[model samples]
Structures are given as structure tokens and as C-alpha cells.
Target: MTGKKKHSEGEIETVAPAAMGTAEWQAEFLTQRRLDKARISARFAGKTLDNFSARDKGRKMLVHSAQTYVSGFNLNKEAGGFPVYPKGLLMTGPVGCGKSHLATAILRGVIEKGYSGLYYNSPDLLRDIRATFQPDSDLTEDDLLEEVTTVDLLVFDDVGAENATGFVLDRFYLIINERYEGCKPIIVTTNLNLEELENRLGKRILSRMLEMCEIFGPFPEEDWRRRNLR
Candidate 1:
């Protein structure tokens, strides 16, 4: 059905494509789904585009570019084609360059579209995994792995900031491998550029990540945090 509006002169003006009967019911269902998604997304993403501070005009422009990707995401298309998604994003830059901020914002966008997601600081995630080894800890190693591996999207922040011990590397490998094999999407933020990242994470993991992600920049600017402080 076509929706119409009354013009000032009392003429009918076509306003939009309207849904009637079954179509209207379906539209209401979709609207409710979006609203529910937005609420769930807020819980997972403590911060949002509104809180992400851009230090300069150039940085603000970069944030907008990321936002465009989030807005354009198609949940049905991604799920139907599982494991062969268009590349997810990998933002690499120096410390405090807003990498995490932008990445989280993007994840939030996807979540709002009814896809589930998770955001984790690399070191914190490792620490939690380690805790599961203690007898007193409530979480199991499998518990952590299952959640991270199965999420619609996983945002791994500060990738190269971890200690990179052998144990840590093995755990990291498991997470990456599961996601890779499942064809799940991921967004990672790191301070290391390609060369340094390749050295830190090894060629195999590096190669897979490169294949899965579209690298965004070293942003090459002062710390966004400091810039925002002023």
C-alpha cells in the first residue's frame, strides 16, 4: 500500500510505502525486534557513538567512515552466507588513538541490527581465562571459549598488548581458529602495524586475520584522549 499525506492545498501526497494487514503485522514485528535489539546492545556496549570523543576533524571523519559500515550491515545476508562475510574491520594505531572507541561503536551498530556481539580487552580476556584454572573460580575454560567463539561478532581490543606467553598464544590461537573455521566475523584493534603484528602474532594467525579483515590505519595523530582533555 502507498501511504499519503495531505498537502496544504488539500491534495494527496505520496509519503511512503505503507504496510496493511499481514504486511502491517510484519512491520510491527520488525519494529519490536529492532527496539529489543537496541536495548540488548546498550547492555553489551557501555559506550556509544554519543560518548566517543573525536580529537580532531580528521579523526571525526574516520569515525564517520566506520559508522557507515555499521549502518549498512545486513544480518540476513551475513548469516545466510555464514563464514564468508565481507571483511570485518581491523583498526591499528598507536595507544589512545580511539581504536577501541570506534571498534566498539561499530559493534554496537551491528548489535542494534539484532545481531549479538561481544567486546573484550585482550589482556582482561586472558586474565579471566587464567582465573578459570583456579579451583575457586566459577567459570570454566570451555565456558569462556564457547561464548567468544559463538558470538555474532567478537571485538578484540588491544590485540598486541598482551604478554604473548606460550600459554597465552595457545589460547588466542584457539579463539581465532574457532572463529575462522566457523566463518564468524571479528573486529580487532591493535597498536601494532602489519609488520609488528605479523611478528607478534606469527605468520599463520596474521595471514588469517589479514584475509578476514580490512585494515584501517595507524591514524598517525596525537592521542585522542589527550586531545579530548583540552
Candidate 2:
């Protein structure tokens, strides 16, 4: 067979690596998935980093911090390797500091990564779920809770936006605690600092949240929203 022009019929196969795949492929796949999710994300008033103006400094910090938390991630990375992820984020700073913006921007990444995510403001969540308790209401509290407690990523905006009552606190705990047990990731945005957060959410919820998240502070030189308001 030497020096002979021999050709055998065989299929040229392409396989994506389960691990250490080509960076281009992985990045491309992730980008596509995000674009798909972004469509849905946009429908809900969620916008990516690009939508907001001049978040250069905060955007870099947020992305890097998210990557750090997400990389080397294990459901059991915490004590007993709780099936739920220990890594969560508390983005705190002044108003218009882009805390909520950053949370959604990360979701932009999640979408590209082809993952499930849920976004809700703390006040709206309480109102919506509580409204179901009205006797004439069609949806049951259990039904609403089930949907909420099961998302892959649950985002809470305006965390201390409302003055929470005991009922809301318990309800909030139930949802977040279940996520904790299930290893789901949660992202919270707040205008409040740690001390103020404790006063608002209370010690128990605070303890649980701290157990789950690493705090990321975005220090803006000015109130971003105020500046943006033309």
C-alpha cells in the first residue's frame, strides 16, 4: 500500500468535548444560549450590562466576582456539601449604583450559559404570592411557592425596599431556605448596607443569607440613577 493513493470511506465526525472542549465552541455555545434567554429576559424589563450606560468599573468587578463564585463551585462545597450551592451574592451600595442592573446582567450570562433563572422584586413577590390567599383567587399559596422555590437562579431586587412583616419574613424564609437546601443560587440587590439589612430582614434570615453568599460592594462615586436622569 506504500506510495499508493488509497482512500477509505469514513465519516468525518465532530464531537464536543464533555470536558476541556475548545474555547471557541464553548464560548459560542454559551453565547447562543444567552441570546436565546435574553429574548425572554428582555420581556421582563431585564436588560444586560450594555443597556445601562458607563458601568465600566462596576461591570468588570461584578463579572469577575460572579466568575470567582461560580468557578470551582460544588453543591457540597459548604459543610456537608449541601446539595444547594453555598455561593450567593449580596450586592450593596447607594441607589442607582447599578445593583439591580448588575444582578440582571449576570442573568444575561446565565441565559447565554443556557441555565434557568427567575427575577422578582422583594415587594412584588410578597404582594403577588399573598394576593393568592384571597378566597376568590384561583392560585393557591402552595402553587406559587412551588414555582418560586424551584428556579435554578432566583433574583431578589429591592431587598429592603419594603418594610417586611412577620408573615412576609416567614414566607421569604421558606422560599430562600428551600433554595438553600436544594443548592439553588440566589442573587439579591439592595440599597442597604449590612447593618441596615439585619434591621430589615432580621437575624435568622440574615444568618441564612450570609451562609449562602459572598458580599460584593459596588462603591459608586455618585448616585448613578440621579446622574442618568436628564
Residue-level lDDT of model 2, residues 1-230, one tens digit each, is 01233255664444434553568777776766545543234543556655655546765666566555544444444456434454778888887667777777766556555466677888888888889989999999998888778866677888988878889888988988998787677888888888999999889888888887778766575676587576
Q: How many angstroms is residue 95 displaced in model 1 relative to the true structure, after the best TM-score fit?
A: 1.2
Q: Candidate 1 lDDT, tens digit per residue, 1-230?
A: 46778978879887755445576666566655644443233433566676766666766777777778787665355456562364677898888777777787787777666677777888888988889999998889999899888888888989999888889888888988888887787888898888998888898888888777887654756775586577
Roughly what TM-score does model 2 have, to 2 decimal places?
A: 0.70
Model number with the top lDDT: 1
Q: What local distance difference test score does each model get?
A: 0.76, 0.71
Of candidate 1, the 10-residue stretch with the lowest lDDT total is: 35-44
Model 1 pairs whose backbones collide: 83-183
Looking at model 1, residue 64 earns an lDDT score of 78
Candidate 1 backbone clash number: 1
Off by over 4 Å in 1: 1-46, 51-57, 78-84, 218-220, 228-230
Residue 7 of candidate 1: its Cα lDDT? 79
Q: Runs in model 2 with CA error above 4 Å?
A: 1-46, 52-59, 66-86, 228-230
